[model samples]
Target: MMHPLSMPELPSGIARVQFEPERVDYAAPEASGRQGGVQAGWPLWLATFELEKVDRDSADMWRGFIARLRGRQRLFLASDPTRLYPKAAPRGFAGMVRAGGGAFNGSAIAWAQNVDADGNADIGLTGLPEGLALSVGDFIGFKWDATGAAAGTYGRRTMARVVIPGVVSNAGAVTVGIEPPLDMLVVPAGAIAHLDRPACLMRQIPDRSSIGSIGTGGALSGAVLVAGQDLRP
Candidate 1:
């Protein structure tokens, strides 16, 4: 079996995707002899995406074939809808995704999807029991299956590590943001900064989950959009 990474050349129409968050100055101007202070706000998250054509034959064996070639891709978000609340995931949040066999072809490559917790995945921003409330020093850390979560199984799949620092903390019906800054797929670098013509349709599920269909808009907020397609050599 030829490894996708080992392939010397990809299909003619295929391309790679890449993206990075736009860097901004966190330091604020100072009234004294020191540098400026940082304004109280969240950093802008940037994600990039690309598209390319893949040989269906070779793609069938590619580790990323499923996510890059499958019918539709999914994205999940846990939020309070108020943009300032400690959000809780619905029952069996990650489990439901696992049951769907999220990626059909990628399983052989160990790209299967799995979450750490069995039921609801909750994020605590503060000890407050009322409306939404998070402290200024609080950080968003993943304690469940988030740690060591990768893409492949049996040494054939890819892995993804997702982490985010808490930029918003307040108590009063707040909504948490779940924008990831990276992708496990091998997309072109240009795809992360622009929007596609189709405008990619977004699907929201009851579990506070969302997914972007392929060839439509699989890339997320931080991801840029490129014209090339995924490749399979």
Candidate 2:
């Protein structure tokens, strides 16, 4: 797992990050009844980041990062550096980088992350974090430690969206419902499960004018960046 403190090699001008919830709603009218509306399942998330005063050196760095990404690569995102999860069980949004570019002057750049773009996987586990309550829309992380008989089936770090919410069963097990089922049949026993609120995928829409300024003297002048989410097969 990559260390959270280790800065991701992204554009240099990123200054702030923001998150938005994604939801779908439907309304219907009956011949003899009032209109009714229904909200879909748990809300997915979107993230946005702001870049400020990107300079020429930063522009080159941004270009290099973008080139490496190839326009839709799945990468882990750490919105908060201080709140990073443990190396053994890192938790964050698994997303793909969207295709975007800055102005000719390289003053600013816009980027976005889509949570549902990658979809989810269904996983069943034998243990539940004691006294922990899970709800729909909560963000969870799954880690398959390289141990146990089923270790080879599970991979490293993966994130998912909770689709069904229920209590721990009498058998001392909790069946987690996630979108997009896990590729393997069984998760390693005692695999790490992380629960966190305020976690989501991010995407930013920057002002085009912010990318038109050229650096003067040795001062940085604008920003550029790209981001995306990993879609499930």
Identify the candidate with maximal TM-score: 2
Please provide, for model 2 over 93-202, each residue's C-alpha lDDT reduced to its tens digit, 9 standing for 90 to 100. 23311123121111112111123344544445334322233455444554444333244343343345556754444333445566434333333334455443212222
**Which digits, one per residue and each the tens of the lDDT, describe model 1 over residues 1-233?**
22122211222222433322223447765677687644343222332222244344333333243243223232212111111112332121232122223421101111112223532122322222232223332223211112243433111211111232232223312223223222324222222111001011111222221122233333222211321112110
Model 1 spans with C-alpha error above 4 angstroms: 1-14, 19-27, 31-34, 37-39, 53-233
lDDT of 2: 0.40
C-alpha lDDT values of all predictions: 0.24, 0.40
Q: By TM-score, how accurate is candidate 2?
A: 0.40
Provide the TM-score for each candidate, comma-separated: 0.21, 0.40
The residue-level lDDT of candidate 2 at 179 comes to 48
lDDT of 1: 0.24
Candidate 2 Cα errors over 4 Å, as ranges: 1-13, 29-43, 54-61, 73-140, 143-191, 195-214, 217-228, 231-233
